[model samples]
Target: MSSTLQLVGMGVLAIIALWVLLQLVGIVFSIVSTIVSFLVSLLLLAIIAVLVYFAFTALT
Candidate 1:
């Protein structure tokens, strides 16, 4: 009976560990996605600025 209890305890521990690892992985992915989105936004803004600059130059 004691051995059975030990096995159950180990299984529970393993599950908890896996859950924590998955949470960490999720957080890492989210952070990476955020950085990528921010970079894309910057690129878009730069493109807009360039277009506006060219337009003003042409007008002048």
Candidate 2:
């Protein structure tokens, strides 16, 4: 009976550990995704600035 209880406890602990690991991975991915999105936005703005500069030069 004790052995059965131990096995159940171990199984539950393993599940909890896996759940925590998955949560951590999700958080890391969220952070990386945000950073990538910000970088892409900045790149787009830079491109627009360059185009505007060229347009101004051509006009002058």
Candidate 3:
């Protein structure tokens, strides 16, 4: 009986650990995705600015 209780306790602990690990993984992925998106946006804006600058120069 004691052994059965111990097994149940261990199972519960394992489940809790798995849940926490999954949450952490999700947060990390979200942060990485946000950073990547931000960088891409900044790069696109810079490219657009450069094009605009060249266009004005060509027109002048």
List CA RMSD, all candidates: 1.2, 1.0, 1.0
lDDT of 2 by residue, 1-60 (tens): 999999999999999999999999999999999999999999999999999999999999
**After best superposition, candidate 2 residue 24: deviation in angstroms?**
0.5
Tell me the TM-score of model 2. 0.89
Better of 2 and 3 by TM-score: 2
Q: Write the per-residue lDDT of candidate 3 for residues 32-52, one digit (tens) a residue.
A: 999999999999999999999
Error of 1 at 5 (Å): 1.9
Worst 10 residues of 1 by lDDT: 24-33
The model with the greatest TM-score is 2
Candidate 3 ranges with C-alpha deviation above 4 Å = none
Candidate 2's error at 10, in angstroms? 1.2
* Count of steric clashes across candidates, in order: 0, 0, 0
Positional deviation of 45 in candidate 2, in angstroms?
0.4
